[model samples]
Target: MKLKKFIISSLLAFASLTFTSNADAASVQTHRVQKGDTLWKIGMNYGVSVSQLKRENHRTSDLIYIGEILKIPQTISAYEKDLLARLVEAEAKGEAYAGKVAVATVVLNRVDSDLFPNSISEVIYQKDQFTPVKNGTIYNPASEASKKAVNEALVFRGQGSGSLYFYNPQKTSNSWLRSKQVTVVIGNHVFAK
Candidate 1:
C-alpha cells in the first residue's frame, strides 16, 4: 500500500511539471526585430510598454538590432488598464465612438514616445497634458463606450501612429499646438504628431 501511494504521488508530480512547462511555453512568444522596428512599435503591436519590453529582454537601452528576438508580455496591470479607461471616458465624453478610441490611442502613443513618460498614468497626469485630470473629471466612472475603446486600442495598435498630441482646434489658442502637423481629425479634436 505504501509503494502504491508513492507511485501515485510521483505520477501526480510529473503531470504537474508537464502542465506547468506547457503553460509557460504557451504564454511566451518571440519576435524577430525587423529593420524599421522600434521598441515602441514592437510594444504597441503586443499591447505592452517599452519599459516592460526592456525589462523582460534585459535591454539597457532602446536600441534593438535587426533579427534580435524579444519576448512580449501579454498582461497589463488592472490599475493601469482602469486608468486608461477613465482617461478615455473623461477626455472623449460625447465624442463619436471612433474618436474615443482615437483618444486612447494617442495616450498609448505618448507612452511609447521618447518625449513623453513611459507609462499610462504618467502620460495622463503630466502637467498641462490632459484637461480631464486637471478638472477632476478623470475620477468619474468610465462610460461603456470608453472602456470598450481602450480594449480596442490595445488589440489594434498604431491606430494613432505618429500622433502624440490632440486638441480641440476650437478651444485651444496654443501657438505651439497650432504649429504641429495634423495626422487626423476625429469628431471635434485634431490629432497631431
Candidate 2:
C-alpha cells in the first residue's frame, strides 16, 4: 500500500512539472544566437529588454554564444499595439510619417518616465492629458501607416528625446506647453520635454 501511494505521488509530481513547463513554453520562444548579433539588437527585434533576455537565459553577462539557444519572452501584446496605433492615428492625422512615429515614441517615453505613469493606458488616459481622449477621437480605428509607425517605434524604442509632450504651436494656446523647450519640429507638431 505504501509503495502504491509513493508511485502515485511521483506520477503527480511529473505531471505537474510537465504542465508548468508547457505553459511557459507557450510564451517563451527559443532563438539560436547568430554571428554579429548583439544582445541589444536582439532585444530590440523581440521588443524585450537586454536585462530580460539575460535573466531569461540565466546569464550574468551580456555575452552570448553564437550557437546558444536563447529563450526570448513574448513580444508586446496585440492590444497594446492596437491602442498605440489608434492613438498615433488620432494625434498625427495629416502629419508627416516621421511625425506619426515621433508621436508614438512620445507615448512610449511617457511609459518610461519617472514623472508620468509607467503604463501606456495610464499615461494616455490620465486626466486632461491628451486632447483626442477628451474629444473622443481616440476611439477611431487606426490606419496602416499608424500601425506601421507603432511597430517601427517599438523597434527603435527609447529613441525619444526625453520628450513627454507634443502640440501644434498654431493650435494650442497652453502657456505652460509653450514655455517648455522644444526638442523637434516635425510637421505641425512641436515635440518637447
Candidate 3:
C-alpha cells in the first residue's frame, strides 16, 4: 500500500512539473521593435500596455527611438500592473501626464472597437490615430498641461462623465463634434463620451 501511494504521489508531482514547464514556455515571447514601431503598437500585438513595455525596458520617456528591442509580457495581469505603474508615474508629473494616460485610454477604447486595431500599439500607431506620436508629439516633451491631463485621466479612468471624445475647440470648428456628448472640460481640451 505504501509503494502504491508513493507511486501515485510521484506521478502527480511529475504531472505538476510538466504543466508548470509548459505554462512558462507559453508565457513569454521576444519582439524586436522596428522603425515606426511604437510601444503602444507592441503592447497591442502582445496584448500588454505601453507602460508595461516602458517599465520592462526602464524607459523614462515615451519617445522610443528606432530599433529599440523590447520584451513583451504575455499576460494581461502583468500588462495591467505595468500600465498602472506608468500611469502613477505620469500622474506625479501633472496634467500633461494625465492627458497622456487619457490618450492611451482612447487608444484602448479603439482597440476594443471592431473599427480599430485589436492592440494598443496598433491603435496608437494606426494611420492618423495620434498626431503627436506620428508628427513627433511624443518627442516634443510633454507640456505641463498635457502631463496634468495624463495624470487626471489615469486616475479618472472613464469615471469623469462618459465623454470619450476630445478636441481642441480653437483648432476644430466642426459643428458635428460640438454636437457630440461632452463629459469633462479640462484646460484647453474638452472630453466627450
Candidate 4:
C-alpha cells in the first residue's frame, strides 16, 4: 500500500514538472513600437499575423502608438517555413537575390492582408493563385538562395514595400494586375500594392 502511494506521488510530481517546462518554452514575446512600426510590419518580423498581434494586445484598431509595448504571440511553424522556401524557389529561381526575397515578402504581405488567406500554405496553394503549385514545381527542392531569401524576409519583414502582389509583367497579360499601383520592380517581377 505504501509503495503504491509513493509511486503515485512521484508520477504526479513528474507530470507537473513536464507541464511547467513545456509552458515556459512557449512564452510570448513583447515588442516596443518604434517610430515607423505598424502592426503588419511587426507581425511580419515576428512571423505572426496582424490580427493575432492585435488580439493579444487587446487592440481594436491598427493604430499602435510609438513606444508602446505589445505582446507578440507564437511564431510560424517549421512546416510553414519550409513551404515558403519551396514556393520562393519555384517562383523566382532565376531572379536576383533581392527579387527572391521580395517574392517571399509578397507572400508574407498577403498573409497580413485582409483580402488573402491567413497562413503561408493557404496563400501559396490557394486555387489558381500560384502557377508553381498548379504545375508541381513547388515540390522541387529549395535552392540555397531561396532558403536564404526566406530567412532574410522573415527578419526584415516587408523590405520597404507594402506589396501584396507580384508577377512577371513580361509573361502575364493580366490587365488588372498591371493596373495595381506598382511598389517596386525587382528583376522580371513587378511587386504591387
Reference-based TM-score of each model: 0.64, 0.75, 0.44, 0.67
How well is each residue in 39-98 modelled by candidate 2, as lDDT tens digits? 777875676666667777888888888998899866577888888889999999999999
> What is the C-alpha local distance difference test score of candidate 1?
0.84
Worst 10 residues of 4 by lDDT: 151-160
* Residue 99 shift from truth in candidate 3, angstroms: 4.0
Model 4 TM-score? 0.67
Q: By descending lDDT, how would the candidates be arranged?
A: 4, 2, 1, 3
Q: Local distance difference test, per candidate? A: 0.84, 0.85, 0.56, 0.86
In candidate 3, stretches whose alpha carbon ends up further than 4 angstroms from where it belongs are: 1-100, 139-162
Ranking by TM-score: 2, 4, 1, 3
- What is the per-residue lDDT of model 3 for residues 12-67, given as tens digits with 9 covering 90 to 100? 99999999999997766768768878765666456555655677778888777666
Q: Please tell me which predicted candidate would have the highest TM-score against the true structure.
A: 2
- Model 2 stretches with alpha carbons more than 4 Å out: 1-14, 30-71
Off by over 4 Å in 4: 1-18, 21-74
Per-residue lDDT of model 1, residues 69-176, tens digit only: 898876456788789989999888999998998888898888878999988889889998999888999998898788778866775554346788899989999999
Model 2 TM-score relative to the real fold = 0.75
